[model samples]
Target: MNSSKPERRKTREVRIGSTAIGAENPVAVQSMTKTLTTDIEATIAQISRLENCGCNIVRVAVPTKKDTEAFAKIAAQVNVPLVADIHFSAQRAIEAIEAGASKIRINPGNMRSWQELDEVIACAKVNKISMRLGINEASIRNLKEDTPSRERTGLMFEEMSEYVREFEKRGFCEIVLSAKSVDVNRTIEINRKFSEGFDYPIHIGLTHSGLPEDGIVPSAAAVGSLLSEGIGDTVRISLAGKPENEIITAQDILASFGLYEKKTPRIVVCPTCGRCMIDVLSLAREIKQAVQEIQKPLKIAVMGCIVNGPGEAADADLAVCAGSGKGYIYRGGKKLAVVPEAELLAEFSKQINLLVAE
Candidate 1:
């Protein structure tokens, strides 16, 4: 475990279906399906893709009874655990629980009243499903329109604590908590407060994180800060791109920190400068797309100049350093073979397969 504050609150282990969150379990990566839940086939297909991309949990919107009905079939067909994102409807939550959702994410303030909240809690308990109390900045209760900036996050924290206390009061401890805000700094602050106040595993992410280049960096920074402090147990990298993109982003972030093992080759490519080399960018793209289906951990480097390439990438398990129209294949910092530029990718692939097979 990463070094954390000595007084870190101990969170109860909550099982979302067969997967356990909190209590020393491996941090999970989750993504929501953009496909409408009623379109079971599309939802299942999207989820299947996410599963292949290493998404541990998948969430689908269950806005109505019909969507709840679809959850049964989708849950049955999908390989990963499923979560139902429910809003404003305890009845739908009940239906989704009956239909086989592993977890339900609800905004406590939106539920009709105390009775409705009780009904939702009861259904979750009876079904033995976990609940995620998802509280966002905009959804926080009892906040004045002109509240001071310094107290805004405190108000959000208070609301989250109230819901968590309510869930505990109902004798239901199977809970995951998320407090997301559009502002990355505020998101970090709220989670930091929660970490001090409670032991429940936190699901941290910046809501509405923009596009790939711009969005991924900040989102990773925010989540990374919390994770480095041993604060987050699961995370979602919300991006405007495809859901698979989010999964890949999450995997990369974890891998960069040495928190996740690469299930596929870890390609280390140098950005081509004025070194004058074969099409390094195009070659890297081709290799990445070509070997996307492989699932073993290996490191491959594509460098522009041989002088610094092999020496700089000496730590790579296998590397191809390009020079002029030729490339040298090196393993463990020793040159093994020289191949024409055109055949470099194929030779690299062959070597990777052999290494992975062994």
Candidate 2:
């Protein structure tokens, strides 16, 4: 019953195109494009899809100049801010920066030397682009060198700190820090250390996760753990399937903790038992599909039994407690009308639609 809000960590704000992240801004939800960045049309279409799903920022991979060429056009056509994912290649990072990337993600462990970093940082500074110093576990040399699992977070912290210091030394302070591991505990610990030591915004995610269907639980666990304590600024749910699914996954995590900006009715349906009447499961599914796009913050309840229905849904904006062949509609615990079973869903839909319009 406790709904205490978590305190967010204060960090420097970094701008990506038109979007502002960190500095206690509403935690931004982001996802990546799965299509090859060289496929300009498909990449733009996917970014548009993610934008429609309430995604705040989107990252696209730029492994080569061709992708950056496509990225230039993609950035011109899309409204959401774009981050170019660059691996160890400094040349590619510079190219993506020139092509209009609002932000660039670089793995600190993968970079060869300070000179290589200086090249990319100089380019980012000139272009006025923010940088995400992504410290990934798999890419880290210490982790690959038979480092004990328990010591990985420490190594990540060390690596991230070194990169952040380098960025500052070069006079490029528009930095966002991220430390990601497949293990949720490591991800949480590394970010906690990062937050305590620096004021830069931190991006949160798991580097390698299972397939989309199987990835949500762990990805949510890692991201939600950090965000709940106010340690994360931007989030990406790294899933193994359609990149847009990552947006939905990220939304579910942020919404569970009440940190997301995009709001809609969250309908609660009773898991029916023998005390139940009416087909609550079918009705709930249909209503969920219908209201997926509504942005208004509303709580709805579809209960199969009348005994604990209205009282349980007392906080809901709208509710329908169904009986054997009739249903009672309630608004904020006050009954409005009785309707036949077949019309219950129809009436409930109309009531919520009216509420949304209001």
Candidate 3:
């Protein structure tokens, strides 16, 4: 399916500010602002950078009235839709809606009573905004003691399903559901079960995926698996780094499944072994740095040996198959030249320049 088009899961399309999610829409990439919500300029700058990095949506924390005030100003200035993250307060949720938030994220399981939850839903309906109704395991009330893995994920499904129905009962349908756990497999499983039981759009991501280097794999395995199976409509890779890095990681996941077709560069490096004579890792690192800013959908491969390198290089737009003392250059899958090891960088750079120019 990576090489062919996939039949995406169908769900009711819901608009989040200027963009739409669910059936027939591209799976949106979103990230949160790391700056303080009270600092309008800093928050706006972060959102602008994320936008430049191709983030489809941005969320900001609104834990105080001052942040809510700043949020309104930021919304008025930014081009992309902003989602207000609300926790432990319903009045603040109402205030955020009035402040021009395109959507609001609230975990109903965290609410002490349905009274406040109902009021928030009413506010969203009145303001014509969308809601991301989530049921985080940590927030669930009175979770059955010593629950089995099956029952735990099922509980998540039940929590999300019940919350969604309650919103529908109050005549609110512009909803995106989420059920996440720090456990990657559980995140994947719950999202699938949640999707099968409802037609509402689902927002998928791992809860508190740690730092970038360690989080990338778990985030991808959870979010990427769902997207590949026609599950996620909108996504965020929750990481402890620059929010823009989350955008990069999310886009990379979408791109891997052929779901995203943005002008981003991709690198294909062979896992070097004893067969490798030249320094493959160092060359690949340099190549990664060199093409970081390239805004073209180019595939560059760095292979270690002629054994499998040439065959793999045949599939890239530009590639180099390094042998003992020389490297064979490939352009558009055809052998262009065989250069000495000392001249490999120059030849690879030349081919890349030509590709970019085209």
Candidate 4:
């Protein structure tokens, strides 16, 4: 596999609180709070959990005046940059920023009046906060107004261009941009155009990605491909589940592209076939469970045959190859033990602990 890192697109740097995106910065991971904004304690607790799990930034929906008030309290209690998800109401957008949002996401197409957008932009400028010109295809009001499904990306790009012009006219360059769609192809297409058309950092995600089981594959496909192309500055997986799960998914996607800063161990196991002579699946599962508390970014492999086992073992820090009733354990490509099948896992665990200790 050609795992060469993608050449990142050049973009102006934008900071949301202390976290920076674009202009060669590592791609940041973001997730939203699923709790109601008015429930200040619950929102705070959820944000804390997200921060603990390595989310770079957290967004909260602030659609009501009371939510903005609660948002202020939530912001006061947390250290992660908070983004206010605003829609339709420029007043809410302004209030959220005033209440201490590091950034606000709004769509100009959703706002009827230029004057209201001006107000939101002006408030953002005064607060010295960043703004994201988020364009969602499903939320575009004129979806059926002579626009074919095939042409939606064009419409989205045009809408984004118009908003960019308006922001630039107001001398507001502290901006991040995003265009999302539930359809994987559209999501990929619109973001590609965003990258080509603007130097602003792009937030990439598949919007309304269904429940975890349904969302993981499409989200991985859309988000992973964009990052691999160097088109995104930040990522949010947007699964309809725990927000922390979204953060984990985002981190995994970034790690696959070698764009994530934090490190965690990686485990590789061969897909056993007719040539296999041991229960590779059960042993691999045991190793995975055993390594939950290990933090070193060690590469571990479990192979069931000679076809690719030795080659894979050469690349791993610790590996085991099984044949019939026994297994061969290797450390740094050198044989360490030949143990019976029943003792393979125990020996593997000891080696893992020793490697981690080192």
Candidate 5:
């Protein structure tokens, strides 16, 4: 009910096991497992970690027969819906469907033939599971060598359109479509086209986004841009590091647009400057750790100086304006108390509990 939330693009709802995509549902945050699918126990453990971190759907690579076998065992043990990542093989896709995949991602550009696609589609229809027509720009074979960036997107869109028509022709409507590019602008442009071109739920993200430190900005720009325009139904941040980081980063992007149901406190801290009096950075760090167990949306601002402190406090549910040896606490933009620096953490914890109780 927040006015800050974007008006979501209305699309046909598709159920992936227990999770629903599109319609009025909150934008789902998803991540792929990094562990080898052949390691069934490790895959299950990773899925558990992802579920604990609020991943709505967990994808695992089923590129090999052994991987699909492991996927079946892993799917049986996890509560989260499993998506089989299939590439180059319709047999693998069919195996994954029989292996209990709630959804499967296959790039139509790479499929050998229409018959193969039809076979995969028929299996998914019979299994009553969903499929993702995932189109990665890099995989489009017809793209001429040294094609311009703009032309590349056109080719991507063309490939996706052909596949979509095939899927629809086969009466396969339980589909989620994705057109991904590593380039930020192209990623946004392609997904926008998908939104306008089809009523299927769109999964948005950049593929091959590098390590976390370097990937976050571009990932945010590509994903956050689509989300702001009400374009994406589900998102993956696609960092090169841990998949948990991917989930966390995706949640942060969704939260920015008010599309995520945040179960953790929202911590806002000022970047301390020369005008700051107390150790705002230290205090903010302490507050972050102290509030780890909080499971509700609480805006706690830790400001270093008087200049921006009061202004930020007006918006935050709870705020601390630090002075020389003491800190001023604000609840609902009204001054609650002034506590010595030593008791700031203790006093702030007390106030947080009271607010939570209320």
Candidate 6:
């Protein structure tokens, strides 16, 4: 049989806290905290929430000395691995590692000079911590005020390769690499080019991907393309909204590609048409909320018309096909019973519970 799955890239395994990244491990989900890191209570609460929502790694910005001091307290309260995002200053990177950050992320090309780079690497080696060499088009120094688009991407790739080589030569191979650009195609191309040359795990995302609704589509397109090609070992769905929304969007993107295991009922609802009888939109919303706490992997279909509903949803584990003001429950394409509109939510929950019990 012919298969469409992308061939896996061979990479060395690196550990972030207790989570093992690269090698044969599943691609991990990552998110950054928007809260001020110095606010111990707020940062811890946000990190706890992200962990509950299936975030595998979390990054906190260490922009100042205060933030570096806060890492010790924040590290004590969170369960997932913590990475300190440092820019320009190698001293802050050393401070954060000493304070117990599991990893530190810096652009090796843009960070200080060779002496400072060695300082950062020495601290990381002594602490036994991992690092991410993040190089982006926006951070590349003095390219041109108006360089051509094509030339800009090429420069970003060249700069990233230099950093990758530097990290490798220093015996600091526990690194993750990212080459981000606002342009989706450029982001994909740079990572693909780097994958061909190195075995370091690539952290993939399109930077500054605007608001939730608009940002999600482009971010998903970029991430999905790379993941489909087996080019990403970790991913972050960057958005301009609440960080929790990023977690939800990331899960949805993975689910769409069938990469994430369906732990909850996968609801398949059709767009209502003129021939629709029941309030399909409202019913689908109600059913989703009603089964929000269910953790079983079941497929549920909600269709507008009865004629094609059951047939179309035959593959679903359970389904609801609407008539005038009523609906029929289907179990594997066979009708089990008629259900009133008011009781649809309850009925679906009851069936899910039965499945869970078994």
lDDT string, candidate 3, 263-289, tens digits: 867888899898997999999898888
Candidate 3 all-Cα RMSD: 1.8
**Cand. 1 TM to true fold:** 0.89
TM-score of 2: 0.93
> Which candidate, 1 or 6, would have the higher lDDT against the true structure?
6
Q: Candidate 4's error at 277, in angstroms?
A: 1.3
Tens-place lDDT digits, model 2, residues 288-331: 88788888877888899988797866878888898879999898
The top-ranked prediction according to TM-score is 4
Measured by C-alpha RMSD in angstroms, how accurate is candidate 2?
2.2
Q: How well is each residue in 122-241 modelled by candidate 5, as lDDT tens digits?
A: 999999999988988878867777899888888888888988888888899999999888899999888888888889999999989999999999999999899889999989999987
Mark the regions of model 5 whose C-alpha exceeds 4 Å error after superposition: 1-3
Tens digit of per-residue lDDT, candidate 1, span 1-358: 1122322236768888878988767778999999889999999999999998889999899998889989998988877999999889999999988989999998888898989989888888888999899988877877787876559899888888888888888898889999888888888899989888988888889999988778998898898787767777788999987899989888787776666776887788887788848888888888788677877777778788876797745787788889878998888688878999889988888876776678
Rank by lDDT (best first)? 5, 4, 3, 2, 6, 1
- What TM-scores do the predictions have? 0.89, 0.93, 0.94, 0.96, 0.96, 0.93
- Supply every candidate's count of residue pairs whose N, Cα or C atoms clash at under 3 angstroms: 0, 0, 0, 0, 0, 0
Clashes (candidate 1): 0
> Deviation in angstroms for 236 in model 4?
0.8
Candidate 5 at residue 50, lDDT? 93
lDDT score at residue 241, model 2, on the 0-100 scale? 81
lDDT of 4 by residue, 228-280 (tens): 78899989998887999998888877777777644566788999899998889
What shift in Å separates residue 173 of candidate 5 from its native position after superposition? 1.3
lDDT for 26 (candidate 1): 72
Compared with the true structure, all predictions reach lDDT values of 0.84, 0.85, 0.88, 0.89, 0.90, 0.85
